[model samples]
Target: MNLRQKIATGAITLCSSTLVLFLGTWEGNGQNTVYADKLARGLPTVCKGITKHTSPDPVVVGDYWSDERCAEVEHLVIEKGQLALADCLTNQAIEQNTFDALTSHGHNFGMPSTCASRAVGLINAGRIADGCRALAKAPDGSPVWSYVTDAQGKKKFVPGLYARRLKEAELCAK
Candidate 1:
């Protein structure tokens, strides 16, 4: 289901396609089919970024998860990530797009890292738009997180990540 579709999960209202679609589209949106990661983190992933490590059931490279299972797992994982991200936020009541964008960013990055990010710090300081922009670039014209270690133990600039951060920043600014 896309973001246009809403389904109830446990207690999280994360069924909106806005967040799900934003994340799912970037996740290289899949259903039951398990495949390799698009980036260098070669984990076997399924559904909307549900890796074998994140799922309740053991997932191998060739695993075939059910759609119901994928949705359930994705919702649960997203809910957990969002909740964790929310806790790191400040007194500001964030907008839906802000929440979605930050949540997705936290999901891709780590919530702990997101919590300690300059973006979160700016958001805490009531600089929402500035905070959103911080995710894409620092004041010195550099990305906050556009590098990933390659198999050769070298940092590689992931254009996809940089693009996604810009998109997230755009969503947040709106």
Candidate 2:
């Protein structure tokens, strides 16, 4: 090859290598990435103790989670929850508090459900206060009637869930 062509090729290779190295280092550090405190608070409350898997279908429960495992799972959930919220927003800019609240709600309720909720509808329609209020309501659009059948088929109100919904609503309002 000609000298000029060889020099250009070398330059291109160097630039590409530098870019790859920079990205790899940045991603490896993970120090700059900041997850929302509200999300962190809400996730552990709803999911309870940590297990290897996040899905409830398999029903894998464990008494303890290593600190590293917990951190990894939290990061994974936050990443997924953020994507879900972003997709639901569809280019709409929202306050950080609202985003964090909705992200947590979505993480708990499943993103599709949250996306299709009346709260989201109201928010999209420019009724922010109404949307926040709607978020505090039960999934069926009723007041927080926090009751569910236990394993023995008895009903009970879960105070934790009720409080979480209230907190989410408050965050949304902010």
Candidate 3:
């Protein structure tokens, strides 16, 4: 209509366009969106390329965080394939390592007597990550488990149950 009104409208349009472009490019950058769905609130955000270990979230059930970067590492395992990733994820339990939480569960549940078989059957064949991603994030938009953040940050587990699983996967190349 008027010159002033037209100019203001044009300015608004330009600003909106720029904002949309900036946000699109910034999406998922330096962030781990793979497990964003599994992240918990009050915990840190999972980025794509910045794994750091500096959060207060504890690993628990419904926690994608295992004090081990299972989620992040899982991607590699998955890309490698089901059978191989299963071997990697369950290596600790198979060895009867006390650190593997799954081992205890496996012994009690009688899934397969060996953690490796159980892991392979459940994760590779059954697709545990698919299920986990749905329920791992917090209500406040943070990670449920601290490990997811750590995984996103590229932190590895020490030489223990979790570490063993990851190491096994890395060694297996699957």
- Residue-level lDDT of model 1, residues 101-170, one tens digit each, is 8887877777798889898899878889888999899989798688888788888898888999999999
Worst 10 residues of 2 by lDDT: 11-20
Candidate 3 on 68-99: residue-level lDDT in tens? Answer: 46334423322222222233453222221221
When summed lDDT is taken over every stretch of 10 residues in candidate 3, the lowest stretch is 91-100
Q: Each prediction's TM-score against the native?
A: 0.86, 0.58, 0.18
Clashing pairs in 2: none
Better of 2 and 3 by lDDT: 2
lDDT measured at residue 107 in model 1 versus the true structure, 0 to 100: 76
lDDT of each: 0.76, 0.52, 0.30
* lDDT score at residue 28, model 2, on the 0-100 scale: 26
What C-alpha lDDT does candidate 2 achieve relative to the native structure?
0.52
Clash counts per candidate, in order, are: 1, 0, 20
What local lDDT does model 3 show for residue 23?
22
Q: Pick the candidate with the highest lDDT.
A: 1
lDDT tens string, model 2, 72-103? 55555555555556656632435556666666
Task: Kindly report which residue stretches of model 2 are placed more than 4 angstroms away from their true locations once superposed.
Answer: 1-59, 138-156
Top candidate when judged by TM-score against the true structure? 1
